[model samples]
Target: MPRERELILGGQRSGKSRRAEQRAADWLALDPAHRAVLIATATAHDEEMRERIARHRADRAQRVPGLVTVEEAVRLGPALARHSEPGTLVLIDCLTLWLTNLLMPAESGSASPALAETAHAGLLHALHGARGPVLLVSNEIGLGVIPMGREARAFVDALGRLNQAVAGACDRVTLMAAGLPLRLKEPG
Candidate 1:
């Protein structure tokens, strides 16, 4: 097998992020030289968010000893391209936050579509062109009822489409629930 492109999808508190981290650690174990890049896509805008981000970072550090963590909430493609080496194992915590950053209040009026498209294009380009193994984490929100507001609806729709595109390109797809992983696709 060349390098694995993995997508781990699940709902909130479904343990998807934990699975992604574990997978990255496993991938890095085979080759210690393979750097573990944690592309954290969250910015702590409030106290709760700050605490959540901190706990996650701490947990990741403990889980993957000596793993290098890079915090690039935005500018994902360029960040990955610049920081990654040939054998790097890149782990993106969640695509949902990245989408939020691109599609949030600043993009309120009619400017959202173009901005979101550009961001999505950049993300897709990165996923396809990344140098080494990549494990992307995202929420599976489409399983629930449609969101009430336009922003929420758009977010869910965009995430669903993005997940589909990534999963199609990926070599492996895993869904997590209650911290257990259900492997959907694996290399034959």
Candidate 2:
């Protein structure tokens, strides 16, 4: 059977991550040996972020006890390749943060376009050929008003493109609003 690939998109606090976790749990429940892995991309660069990460960990432990976590802030393609296997489910907590990490300026104060492109290509390739169920979560930033800053605008554009590419690769695509999921794409 072909693997299931899903993309969950939503605004902040719209329950995208929660939805992904629920789907992962459901997939894991199908078989005793089915394993769930969360590929977390968020970094604890601030106290608030650290707290948020901690809360997520606690929630996952309580809500999805069997799910394991893998922290991959940049090299998501390699991580996915290593974890995605038959009878395993991988949930990428987010793609927006991962894009941000790729776009961040180096000490020279310039973003490397080649590096970002390569990483993006690698991730898409991995997702397209994954051997197990994969759930990817990403913020829907295109609905908002235009940003004034150039960097912010670039980030938004990159995220929009990334989401579109992932959605194309996914067998299912869902938009979350008010904790409700509206299916955009259904598996054939």
TM-score of every prediction relative to native: 0.91, 0.96
Which digits, one per residue and each the tens of the lDDT, describe model 1 over residues 1-188?
A: 23678899999999998788777778778775667888888888789998988898788889987567787766787776775567888888778888777777334443366777877778778778887878889989899888899878878888888889889888999998899999999966
* Candidate 1 global TM-score: 0.91
- Model 1 lDDT, residue 72, Cα: 74
Candidate 1 lDDT trough over 10 residues, lowest sum: 104-113
Identify the leading candidate in terms of TM-score.
2
Residue 66, model 1: lDDT of 55
Native RMSD of candidate 1 (Å): 2.0
Which of the numbered candidates is closest to the native, going by highest lDDT? 2
- Model 1: runs farther than 4 Å from truth? 105-111
| lDDT of each candidate versus the true structure | 0.80, 0.90
